[model samples]
Target: MVYQTDLDAVLDFPILIGDIGGTNARFAIVVDSYAEPREFPVLFTADFPTIDDAIQSVLDQTSLLPRSTVLAVAGPVDGDEIDLTNSDWVVRPKQMMKTFGFGDVIVLNDFEAQALAVVALGEAHLEKIGGGSAETVGSRVVLGPGTGLGVAGLVHAQHTWIPLPGEGGHIDLGPRTERDYEIFPHLERIEGRISAEQVLCGRGLVNLYRAIAAADGKEAPFSDPAEITSAGLERSNPLATETLDLFVTYLGRVAGDLGLIFMSQGGVFLTGGIVQKIVPALRNGVFRAAFEDKAPHRTLMAEIPVYVITHPMAAVCGLGAYARTPGRFGVETAGRRWRAR
Candidate 1:
């Protein structure tokens, strides 16, 4: 059901915007351009049977009729197909467009959209974690650890921001402490690979909990991450507290390494569910300690600003930005060359 492609002005087109994580899918109808959208509707995917159904429920939030949509999903989007890494939802882009009655559909990797959004954000939105201020427009890195660890980077060139995706989270994790060394073997016993995702994601915290508990010769406590976090912060469980400490330390190490590799002089933005779960811990743990631990170069790296995106719909804003310019990927260079005229 294709509409008139010649809608030149896009005046009445209410673009449906969304940020689809594995657990929730937030839907909104942008009455105007994405730069300054007004009305919004958010939803949880678990409450619906399919993505289509979720969108339908979102539409019911108001009388606004949507003509197009840009969905940001937390998973690999190759060709026209996408399968959420943490959920059972699978979608075909073309099919979704047809079903939703939209002439065109924009589907992007949620992290990629996040990288794009870094270009559009203003000062008031981002919360500074550590480090001083950001460079004007140098190389930057964005990382999120939710259901899994998502890695993406953006470089400025040709007056545009280009996002680069990487499977770096799956890279082998290395420990830098005596406690880490003890925990590493236990982690390896459980996951075998001990990938960054194993220690950096929501589940990764639980993994750290198990490993640390075992290292302390204690049995694995709870089955849920919330339980572990609760025990650590509220209940004051010794094992959970120690595990959270080590997890933050290792995360700092990984973030520090990533910063060096990317040479992110602009800044590094830390986001995702786990970080939100332990915001206070970030101030106390390895997040900055490990980040500034890079010897000799440590002082230089410390100059690089770091922030945590507190906005819940950050990725949605990113997806909305992606809908405006297509094919912004595939031409990024280490020297910061973007695919612009």
Candidate 2:
């Protein structure tokens, strides 16, 4: 879908778009709307003590400073203080502006930015997971499991797009099967209270593996999600395979529930690093089955299209779009728009 926005408007100043997640921080510069975004080297979030450190590192290496910036963070955004849910990085927009002397700084929930990117995405950016055609006019939801589970929604109203961001990942995990029941108790005990994030993130992969192992009276020795995923995809380890299967199934169930809640007939997009790595597992029918398992609303669920965003610059595109036509995005910053310093 080609976004109907003017890219030239955003190029008046050197604009920096940062997609900061628990695992990685991706930076890009907006040269023109018709041109490809120039990206910086990927920075691991854990290596830096704070967001300021990471930004400074990028500045030091690139020898260029942005006149304005939009940072997409993996957490809730409220006021001037922002903290990442899965990483120990706190970002303060006011403090950052004082330190860097930028003209404007905008902070957004990572998935909120994802919601905006959904509109800017083209067919080449999306891969259909399941469902029939999208409703063309309604709500569209985007959720994904990565360093943590992120959820957001987008709706078109009065020829403008609005993004709804919330901590939907922290919702309670609902069990739907005998295996689910067996594992629920373990996850609850392990988390002190079982939230969806406890079992749907990178850490959640290991958590599921351990929970399944505990349920079957076996010991799970895996320490990393990558190790578990490798073992599962290869099918060399039965426990690992079961763990991945359970993860995909639960993901589908949660996605279905979200679709029904939002009535996301427009579409549901899965955006995250983890899903991109496990695309094969998502296509093996387990995910689709669980997604359509809504009893009375099976037909409604089938009508809601779902796709995975494969674009590396999804969130950046959203930030750039908002920069071009902030009013169309319905984002209120009290008239504080991006300007060259």
Top TM-score prediction, candidate number: 2
Tens digits of lDDT, candidate 2, 251-307 = 998999899888999998998878887888999999999999999999888778889
Give per-model CA RMSD. Answer: 5.5, 3.7
TM-score of each: 0.86, 0.90
Model 1 — TM-score against the truth? 0.86
Top candidate (lDDT): 2
Query: How accurate locally, in lDDT, is each candidate?
Result: 0.71, 0.81
lDDT of 1 at 234: 64
> For model 1, which pairs clash?
none
Give Cα distance to truth, residue 227, candidate 2, Å.
Answer: 1.5
